[model samples]
Target chain A: AQSVTQPDIHITVSEGASLELRCNYSYGATPYLFWYVQSPGQGLQLLLKYFSGDTLVQGIKGFEAEFKRSQSSFNLRKPSVHWSDAAEYFCAVGPLMDSSYKLIFGSGTRLLVRP
Target chain B: DAGVTQSPTHLIKTRGQQVTLRCSPKSGHDTVSWYQQALGQGPQFIFQYYEEEERQRGNFPDRFSGHQFPNYSSELNVNALLLGDSALYLCASSLWGQTSLDTQYFGPGTRLTVL
Candidate 1:
């Protein structure tokens, strides 16, 4: 079955530090990948998505993810971490079927930014 | 344009009760999907509706149902609510048939608590 795995349940980094969140997916065919961030008591916000073309995809809030087909991974990265960036990040893989996009999401990674 | 919106920001229901959550898609979006986000977990797809019909569903039981209207607004209904059924219900909208690659925009989500 198709599934997304976010190995890290939580990661802590100092403010202004670089951030990297790992994600791996298992799917039979090439799939659309996405990264979303959610704050406490808030809905998810789309950070980035990967379809065809360039592997490096940039999203809002200076977040970017690289799609590595060989590794079946799409990892999110940020050059500088801010306190406001302390939120839960999720990785999702979607496949189009019957004119619908059904997404399978990973458990999520919670980021804690330290001062 | 207005973003995806959900009604009843929070609701409390007792066991065996039923509850309904509403969603209005973002402007120009024609597809609506529902998801359940348990605390500390990622959002899981419940179902997707397009053209006023259910196109695809997740592994949820029949107790979970949904409907979509012509204006692209939708509702999620849950029957026989269990304590475990309490979660944040998220509504996402996108233009499915218009493009092969679509990004789902999420609403603020409805928090349902079962007592």
Candidate 2:
């Protein structure tokens, strides 16, 4: 079955420190990968997506993710952490079907930024 | 353009009761998808509706049903709700065409509490 795995349930980063969140997926074909961030009690915002072509995709809020096909991973990274960046991050994979496309999401990783 | 929107930011219900959640898609988006996000977990795809039809669905039971309107709005209905059914219901909208890739935009979820 197709699924996404975000191994880290929670991560803590000091302010201004570099950050990396790992993700892995299981799918039959080249999957469409996506990263989304959700603030508490708010809707999810798209961080980035990998459809085709480039392995490295840039997203909002200075976040980027590299899609490694061989490893079945798409890890999200940020150069520096901000207090506002603390939120729940999810990794998702979507494989298009005949008439519909739905996302398969990982459990999610919550980030905590320390001052 | 207006973003995707959902109604009733929060709800409290009892077991065996039914609930209906509404969603209005983002401008120009033609497909609506519903997801259930439990506490501390990623959102699980429930179903997707397009052109007033249920185009695709996840592993949800028959108790979970949905409908799409001509204006690109949608509704998710759950029957015989249980305690496990309590979750944050999210609505996402996207455009699915032959040449375009799916990029979903989410609405502020409805927090459901089953007691």
Candidate 3:
């Protein structure tokens, strides 16, 4: 079974500071990884995904993630944090074969940006 | 383009009651998947519908059922709801493909509360 693990339950970052949220995944084969952000009372928005090529993937909102196959990790990062960037972040893994892909998500990491 | 839409933004129902949540997929999307997000937790996959048929399902029990319409809209029905069932029901749409790299667009979830 595929699973995702986000070790950080909560992270507090000062405004303008670099931010990194770690994610580790477990899968039998090459996993399709994704990062999603959910604001309070809002739907989740896809941040980025890693399927085949470039291990480094860019997403909206000044976010990017690097997929390290050797480490089985796909960590999300931002050059600088902003107050508006505070939200819950989830890491998910999907298989690479079927169209009915189901995502196995981590418990989530809540980000708090301090001004 | 209008994103995926879910009806009844919030609803309160008593235990043992039945509730139905509706979803309209984004334009050009042919598959709809449902997820349940508990407070302080990540979303859990429920099932997916394609071509008016259930193509995949998660570990949820039979008490949770759904239907897909000819128009590509979908409905999730939960019977004999329990307090544990109170969560944000999210609807996601995607274009089914042979590979699992398909991106799923999510809608603002319907918040359900069981009293």
* Alpha carbon lDDT of each predicted model: 0.92, 0.92, 0.92
lDDT of 1 by residue, B26-113 (tens): 9999999999999888999999998999988999999999999999899999999999999999999989874455667899999999
TM-score, first chain, each model: 0.97, 0.96, 0.96
Residue A58 Cα positional deviation in candidate 3, in Å, after optimal superposition = 1.3
Candidate 3 lDDT score at position A60: 92
| Superposition error at B83 for model 2 (Å) | 0.5
What does the lDDT read for residue B96 in candidate 1?
Answer: 80
**Interface DockQ of each model:** 0.66, 0.63, 0.66
lDDT per residue as tens, model 2, B14-71: 9999999999999999999999999988999999998999988889999999999999
Interface RMSD of 3: 1.8
Model 1 superposed RMSD (Cα): 1.2
**Model 3 interface CAPRI class:** medium
User: What number of backbone clashes does candidate 1 have, counting pairs of residues 3 or more apart or in separate chains?
Assistant: 0
- Tell me the spans in candidate 2 whose CA falls farther than 4 Å from its real position: A98-100, B98-102
Writing each residue's lDDT as its tens digit, candidate 3 over B1-115 gives: 8899999999999999999999999998899999999998899999999999998898999999999999999999999999999999999999888344457899999999999
- Going through the candidates in order, what is chain B's TM-score? 0.96, 0.95, 0.96
Model 1 over residues A39-108: C-alpha lDDT tens digits? 9888889898887899999999999999999999999999999899999999999875646678899999
Clashes of each: 0, 0, 0
Q: Which residue ranges in model 1 land beyond 4 Å of their true spot?
A: B99-102
How well does candidate 2 score on lDDT at residue B1?
Answer: 88
